[model samples]
Target: MKRIVAGGFFLLSGVLLYLGVHLAAAMYLPHITGWSTPPGKYGTALRETGGYAANLFSILLMIGGSLILLIELYFPHAAATYKKALAERNREYEKKHNLRE
Candidate 1:
């Protein structure tokens, strides 16, 4: 189960990161990649409209995806340690208050 969940997260984060890069490239370097918007008055060329919004979203996606991937890959033990510490603290608090877990 744990391995399955980790694999799923890895796939999800990879897709998100890929999408961010693809969007950024399409927006800024359409010529190099040969990506462009449809022929219409709204978008005269590549990345002409909603440039700021698209840029912001792409940045967010990249950051979020990378953070998630890093945490899952490098900090799995950190989460276990944190949970143990939290439980210990809770037990101490309960003991001080003369309460049972």
Candidate 2:
């Protein structure tokens, strides 16, 4: 149940993050890419393709998506480690008292 919940949250966060980055690109492109409203004009083509911002964002999204998916693949291992950490902390707390399994 916890794993399921964590995965759902991660998915939601990833989607939202991607959307925000995409929107930023749409706004920042005109400046960073230097695209003109009217094409075929003087200095009409700045990049003639895409800008650094778009490339950077694309790379970032790819890397971030891969990382998130990688982490998700190891969810079971992470959950186990998380449980062990919690157990160790609980042991420290119950040093003065008994804890029920």
Candidate 3:
């Protein structure tokens, strides 16, 4: 129960973090990387403007965290069900073909 709730919270936090990072990136990436000049160089612009590589890294981090949390909570049952179904299908196929394993 606690794990399930924690998973839900992690998912929600990830979504919110992604949204915030997306908004910040949309607002600043153009300014940082839009032109060819010293100030517009990626490193210089990010350093001056207090910007980080938020768009790509934040999204990846959020997705990884959320999936880790949620999958840990839910994937065991799903995996077991899938394994059971596959085993049953293999058994049926073997029976039909008079094959033994």
* TM-scores of all predicted structures: 0.35, 0.35, 0.42
**Deviation (Å) of 44 in candidate 1:** 13
How far in Å is the alpha carbon of 18 misplaced in model 1?
Answer: 9.2
State the lDDT at 65 in candidate 3: 63
- The number of clashing residue pairs in each candidate reads 0, 0, 0
Model 3: lowest-lDDT 10 consecutive positions:
42-51
State the lDDT of candidate 2 residue by residue for 1-101, as single tens digits: 55445555655665666565555545654655344565432223323433444545555655665566667678779999999999999888887576555
Q: Which regions of candidate 3 deviate over 4 angstroms?
A: 30-61, 68-101
> Which ten-residue region of model 1 has the weakest summed lDDT?
39-48
When 1 and 2 are scored with lDDT, the better candidate is 1
TM-score attained by model 2: 0.35
The residue-by-residue lDDT of candidate 3 on 25-93, one tens digit each, is: 456666663556754554454444444555455566567667777787679889999999999999999
